[model samples]
Target: DVKVTQSSRYLVKRTGEKVFLECVQDMDHENMFWYRQDPGLGLRLIYFSYDVKMKEKGDIPEGYSVSREKKERFSLILESASTNQTSMYLCASSLYSGRRYEQYFGPGTRLTVT
Candidate 1:
């Protein structure tokens, strides 16, 4: 089964504190992604990595970054957690077979910046 695991289910961070959220996929998918899900706004991509040690910025990469050091693991880093950054962060992964692959999502990490 394709499974994705997020590091935290919930987080309370102060404004300006660096935050890190980790994710891992057991299925050897080549594309891993970080996204923030908000009400009425839908899912917005934060970053993605296509391969180990390679990364790319996504739609909302501004205060956020990502790392993919190994095939099964991906990490999202928030330079400084802000009140506006508080939201549900989801991690997803998809295969690179050129076929239409649906992303498998994690349980999500709800962050509250105070």
Candidate 2:
């Protein structure tokens, strides 16, 4: 089974602190992504990595960065956590080439920046 594990199910931070969220996928998928889900807005991609050490910026990569030094591990770094950044962060994984390449999501991390 495709499994993605997130570092935290919930997180609380101050207005301007650096936060790091980690995700790991056991399926060895070539594509991994980080997204944030808000109330009105659907899931917006923060960043994605197609391969190890290769990354792509998604729609909202303004205050975030990512690292994919290992094939199974991807990390999302929030340069400065803010109240506006409080949202549900989801990590997903999918195969690079497949017929039905639907992303498998993690449980998600609910971050509250106070």
Best by TM-score: 2
Off by over 4 Å in 2: none
Q: Could you give candidate 1's per-residue lDDT for residues 1-114 as a string of tens digits?
A: 889999999999999999999999999999999999999999999999989999989998999988888999999999988899999999999998879489999999999999
In model 1, the runs with Cα more than 4 Å from the true position are 98-100
Candidate no. 2 TM-score? 0.97
Whole-model alpha-carbon lDDT for candidate 2: 0.95
Q: Candidate 2: worst 10 consecutive residues by lDDT?
A: 93-102
Candidate 2 lDDT over residue span 1-114, tens digit each: 889999999999998899999999998899999999999999999999999999999999999999999999999999888899999999999999867589999999999999
| Number of clashing pairs per prediction, in order | 0, 0
Question: Which pairs of residues clash in candidate 2, taking residues 3 or more apart in a chain or in different chains?
Answer: none
